[model samples]
Target: MTSKVHLPYFDHLLELLKDQNQTAIAAFGRHVHWGYWEDPSSADGSIPDFANAAEQLSRRVCDAAKITDGLKILDCGCGFGGTIASLNERFSNLEMVGVNIDERQLERARSQVHPLNQNSISFVCADACNLPFEDNSFDVVLAVECIFHFPSRETFFKEARRVLKPGGYLAICDFVPLKFSLPFTHLIGKFLTTSVHNTYGTIKSNFSLSTYRQLAQKTGFITRIEEDITRNTLPTYPLVRKLFRENGAAETEKITAGAELVSKLGITRYLILSFEAIDP
Candidate 1:
């Protein structure tokens, strides 16, 4: 578990997210991960219900993690703590802790998430590579669209395993390349909604799904469920494309479009992977 993120892009991202940007925040209604569109028909619409779509995506991820009423969960790279907030409403008497390296996001998330949800809901400013909690502390560790932003996805995996109880789950939706190639691997990052359009941003990992599954296997976890929900989430790219253009990200707009085309051509694999940490 060595860090892969360094320098300008990660630094640039910190500054960009220090304060709430109206354009970016609008896409999430506070939850800013790439949304899941439950309605396949909405995938190609000129105007998709992004708020609804975003919530659906979170719920989908939540469902995969099997979030229960009383379980303790950690949302790694939890931005604005929106997922926790949503979960709080549905799952009562639960302890929800969201950890992120960004202070601004923590500040906003604290504002949005009430301290009392029949159980405490809190935010912590901590790195994903090294969590601030004791080992085996949580029932589940969730990363929705944010694992790729980690300094090392593998490190986060190891850390999540340490923090999670033996049967606890790690649920995530991450970008995976169809096949690893130097050219396509480099190009994939540009199309993502994670990075701000033209700025030098964090380098994203484009590991294939199999590579990740193998990593999970090596990490002492079993892949309980791994579904390619790519088609279900296709509405994200077009909306992101238009959002970039409207927000004056000319370069990112093209990249977003390019990413969309390849996705349609069946190259990009956005997966919902849930693994349960098991002791050997």
Candidate 2:
């Protein structure tokens, strides 16, 4: 039997198109770092039992989305269905579903989310840029911390619009650059890590908040909120480092150094955006 080999960045995505379910499950199983998915309460040694930041972000995004009961919600780039599980727990009335391009992650999501426990939840492997759902299928479409991987922001916005019902909403949480110069720390980190492919790699991505809002508006969605969560990420960097140290990951040392460098460089950080679908 011939063993499978990973393709290049974009080609890997195309292969995922063959069966989104399998792709998600396989990719997550092989690549995801579960420790990084820490609960916010457990984030810092001082912030005891606080709601997880990611969960809080998910909640805030949902709030920003203004979803109502019986609303069809699509979680684009829903990694291992974390957001889906979070939102479902908070709002049982919502009809929540998630889509990703990795099959391995989808498998974990299915296994973790019991069928009888929350029938409203569903996970499938699908591309974020080109969603497979029919037009106007959902009341809300959310892409949390995942849209950065999208090859084309415009296509992603268009697809989100296509799947969302009139008057529906869209929310995205991702990293954005603060200034023009490429931070040296990142370049150094990349050189240290096993290329961008083997680890959390940056791509031909843009970071300006203005650019994001402009893309959304140009793609036909009404951009609502552009929030700065940089402080949140910076403060919690230590916590993530602690978690990594506890887990004994070799990358812990590098991440700690990188965090310090990031702070010193004065780079603007990650953020979450909210938008609404409006037809002219």
Candidate 3:
């Protein structure tokens, strides 16, 4: 990430999140990523469920990260410990830590901890840009659609690098615009969108795929896998549209539709990038 920072921090949203832990921005309470639907279009006329598809995207991230037994993982900006629960169920001998900026969300995440893995999975309230862990501590750091909310994604990149053991991986799931327009396209997207999730309130989360790749390289990491899963995630718009309507936000329909349309046209992308740590 270049030092010519263009975006602002999300400090103001922290003030608004005191009691919004149970608030479900997406259809599910646990997930917030653009869900991965095998068929974005409802050609078969099957019932669409948001949480189910969101789990698919989580699995995709886990697969790309090659999560396995005996590996320690960090879920940075982990909304409600969904990744922890998912991975804990799949792998037996795994140790996990989940961190969220908000204490309220961290409380909920801590509650999700299983009795069996209570000794293994732990949640901490901390800033992602400044993780509260030692260097070379974890085998992997997974940030699912939450980096954009951080004050400085570059700082978080450095922190992830610092905490990861050599040969460890960083997996990120985020929305990447087609063009690399800073402070402009992202600014407009916030106005058009509905809920004003943590990052959109400050426009801190505004980088395209190309920009992220460049930043990773600049931060001393190797991009091992970059997948554009727009097709798999496009189906999430309808779910978000319903959420906006159910909350009496009638004006967000157009904005949600616009996002979906732009994504289909390749002007926006839902991407999963896996980077491996190496000597810089």
Instruction: Tell me, by lDDT, which candidate is best.
Output: 1
Between candidates 2 and 3, the TM-score winner: 3
True-structure lDDT of candidate 1: 0.76
lDDT of 1 by residue, 1-280 (tens): 2123332333433344555655555664467766677667845544447766778888888888988889999998887888998898887888889998777667778877884569678898889999989998999999988887688888889999999999889999886777645366565544554553334346465678888888899887999878887787788887877766775667667766766776677777778889999985
Candidate 1: where are CA atoms >4 Å away? 1-25, 43-48, 115-117, 180-183, 186-197
Worst 10 residues of 2 by lDDT: 1-10
RMSD each, Å: 4.4, 6.9, 5.8
Give the poorly placed runs of model 3, Cα more than 4 Å off. 1-26, 42-48, 115-119, 180-200, 251-254
Kindly state the number of residue pairs that clash in model 1. 0
Kindly give the stretch of ten consecutive residues in candidate 1 with the minimal lDDT sum. 1-10
**Best candidate, TM-score-wise?**
1
Query: lDDT (CA) for every model shown?
Result: 0.76, 0.62, 0.73
Model 2 Cα lDDT, one tens digit per residue, 86-114: 66666656777888777655776787664
